[model samples]
Target: MINTFKKDDAQALKGIAIIMMIFHHCFSSTELYEKYTISFFPFKENIIVNIAVICKICVALFAFISGYGLIISYEKKKATASRWALSRYIKTFSGFWIIYILLAFVNIIFRSRFLKVYFGHGIWIGIASVFLDFAGFAKLFGTDTLLVTWWYMSAAVVYILLVPLLYKELKDKTWIILIFSMFFLRVILSHTDAGSFTGSNSIYAFIPVFISGSIFATTLFFSGGY
Candidate 1:
């Protein structure tokens, strides 16, 4: 009968998401099948690919957990919302940038095919592309990301920037906020080149699920559901 989402629940959801991510990345595409040494399934390859495709929900799971955990933690912290968000922004990007810089270094040093493919023609354009990727705006601005998986970075930035700004408004009006997020997501999908599944790098595409998590947390904490 306990419906409360405790910190342990959040961590458990995260663990599940991570496992799904690994499965999705490992078997999602047939092109990469050659990279793996073993395939236990003797049936059609599409079966595994289909299962992997379904595992793409991992992104939504992670987003939900992020929204839920952020609201829960924010409610307990003594710092102002903006300050808390700033600290989170710094922490997230600092960790990301370390790996980003290292990857960029290796790419440039080796003149990897990634640079050749998405560098966007000229030197200035290439630099701009790199800058866009670094700032996590590549997907937002319709620029190419240096790495395919980095599309999530843009979504992460959007989520981090939005949570602090909307958490209070979502406190009592969770349903209203959730509806608005869904409407916003639909609008973005209708008008833009944003896609679903792996190409859903745009925050507008996934904001509803993210806000759903926040609403769940708000309900649990404020409605005596705990």
Candidate 2:
């Protein structure tokens, strides 16, 4: 048969990991784990979860690349680390906010008649969220931003503070620092008890991904960010 698949190790690993992930998700745990000893059931002893978690570990592969990429990006472009970091922050946040605002504007302008008639409830709720984000008083008002992804802006701000630390004397120890930072943050954030809807987990979920990403970065074994 003609070659139909990517031959790269990294590519192969990613595909296999994803298949393993899907396999664990699709099959009942007892059937897969009791027999194949592989599935993702979300417990330490669960063979399926183990298999799935292994595949989920791909992010570590990108940790090193992120460190290296950031350094290269700052240096080659002749931009100060501060400027580079700020630019990235603005780009990420403003991009998301802009989209939210634009959509909300259209929705509101149309909401009285056509928008409500045409668009569904979820979309209208989204417009409301955007209006809340712009207000900047959402928390006090017991509201939230128009889009859930806006929370990432807050997270990105945290990264901005950490990056210069990464850019300075701490650069070479990127992997180690990333691990520790993630662990500490995971511990602290876990206490907040955020919900599943946010995809922002407590320590139980996040530390694993960060550690996995850090491992992949330092080892140069895989290439994924999160």
Candidate 3:
């Protein structure tokens, strides 16, 4: 009883997610989006909002895909955790740091007040602030004005760091525990002031969805779908 999953199907789903994300961004702004809200389009606002909501799922899809891909790779390669971490860190951070350096240069040339406004300290403090922003701690501290969208990188890194621990300790029950813990944390946080802290972009919000992908891959393998 060999169960087969099509790579093409997965790729197609990713393509759909990408399209949804693009549509979400396109409809996010008023000036450019007004063209869709004109006379002929009766339920334009509703449709746009629905699209925006649906597009939020794309983030989960991305995290799932990442987890699935990494788990599958780990299964195939049987790589050591340290090796994997080093490789992943180099692969992930190299491009980001390169871009960050370029942006820093641009900021310096333009004599941008961004650092002073955000950090409000001397050059050493400004450098520390930049590092914090790059590591995604600035967002937690409410100073993530620089590269605000890069919070995903920090969350991904945290997940990557957790992978070795999860793989070692919860090799069998990863899915169940991850799903349960995520919901439990969500419920707990919702009752407290931390509820506002666990928005869609945060690491805590995405961990369950990401680990679900690993579970899916594991199930597929056991079910002879690999």
Clashes of each: 0, 15, 0
* Tens digits of per-residue lDDT for model 2, 1-226: 2222222543555566557546544442454446564433455455544554454333333222333344334434457777877787666466666775677777668655324432345787656744556533343244454444244344334444455554453337556666677667666666666322123312223333434433443343533222
For model 1 the local lDDT of residue 127 reads 83
lDDT of 1 at 5: 65
lDDT of 3 by residue, 1-226 (tens): 5555445656776898788777666664456567564542666676676666567677677777766666655565556788888787777688888887787778767977566545676777766777777655665555544666677777777767767765653466656776687788778757655454323556556666677776776674423333
lDDT measured at residue 93 in model 1 versus the true structure, 0 to 100: 83
TM-score of 1: 0.81
Residue 15 Cα positional deviation in candidate 3, in Å, after optimal superposition: 3.4
Residue ranges of candidate 2 with Cα displaced over 4 Å: 1-77, 112-143, 194-219, 222-226
Model 3 has a clash total of 0
lDDT by residue (tens digit), candidate 1, 16-39? 988988998888887767766765
TM-score of each: 0.81, 0.45, 0.74
Ranking by TM-score: 1, 3, 2
Clashing pairs in 1: none
Deviation in angstroms for 79 in model 2? 2.0
Model 1, which residues run further than 4 Å from truth?
A: 1-3, 35-37, 42-44, 114-120, 174-177, 180-199, 221-226
* RMSD value for candidate 1: 3.4
